[model samples]
Target: MDSWPHPQPLTNRLELVAVPRPVLTALVSGRAAAALPPPLVTPYLAGEECAGLWRMRSMQLSDKPGDAPWVTRFVVVPGVSGAVGAAGFHGAPDQVGMVEVGYRIAPEHRRNGYARQALEILLSVAGSSPDVRVVRASISPENHASRALIQQFAFAEVGEQWDDEDGLETLFEMVLRTQ
Candidate 1:
């Protein structure tokens, strides 16, 4: 990843803020600012659903040390400018080394290429990890932007699933090119 335009500094644009469950709980409780200090991007979303998911996962994945750092990350830009949104693995790889990915950019940051850049970084991480073989993203049919983003790589439509929160979702998957 040396070719990445942004320096490796933690505060650089397109930073990945690791939200371990404890950190996420702090963010939700307004204690993260003091506890974690600077450069750790917190959830900027007003949506309670996303916040709750972070809290719930904190307990669910508590025992899995590998998932704590990469499960959910805030996508920040402009060298500590702040979080524009988030992207991360839904969880650690399953028995077959498959993991799901999800990402969202803030409304104000749309069309800024932040989401794409963040997804690329995340994919790179997953691709290089020995534990991850496939990455999947579930998107609504109406989300043309999301569809286009995944298509930028070698991703393909593998299937669909029904979700209580999002209804029917089209599943896209990519076998990581590790070689």
Candidate 2:
């Protein structure tokens, strides 16, 4: 089990656990039902909607063995046995010290502070990294909740882009640290 990165001041209610390599493998191989026992894997994690994302992460791990810590993580409550959502950096900081973040809260888990907590955790991690100077979030224009969440952190609307999978996205960026 690769050590999952937990760059702290951790949130009181949420914990981000690294999705183990075994779990990713099972998810990408479509053998989660057989490879992962119940309660160890969530249906959302193994579902079709997230299959491509998981596969992409798997490819990242295989291509860059040291990037495990920067990949997908399960957002769980400390005392809770299951995850409420997923969040993490798109990858390690780029040459210019920018790291993009992505997150999702399960439908049933939405409307709570989980997404906010997850963003806080991601920003904490980014701020702790010397190589990370800018934290970026590409939210769809229709994702009002995410747009609002980043606004609370003072992220500037730097630009926008077209994602083949997610449609048009508004790009937001915040300095990782005041420095």
Best by lDDT: 2
Per-candidate alpha-carbon RMSD to the true structure: 4.3, 2.4
Q: Residue 13 deviation, candidate 2, in Å?
A: 3.1
lDDT of 2 by residue, 79-157 (tens): 5556777889999888889999999887878888888888888888887789999999999999998898999996999
- TM-score versus the correct structure, for each prediction: 0.78, 0.90
lDDT of 1: 0.72
All models: lDDT? Answer: 0.72, 0.82
Window of ten residues with lowest summed lDDT in model 2: 1-10
Candidate 1 regions off by >4 Å?
A: 1-13, 28-43, 63-65, 177-179
The parts of candidate 2 lying over 4 Å away from their true place are 1-11, 177-179
Model 1 steric clash pairs: none
Candidate 2 structure, TM-score to reference: 0.90
Q: Which of the numbered candidates is closest to the native, going by highest TM-score?
A: 2
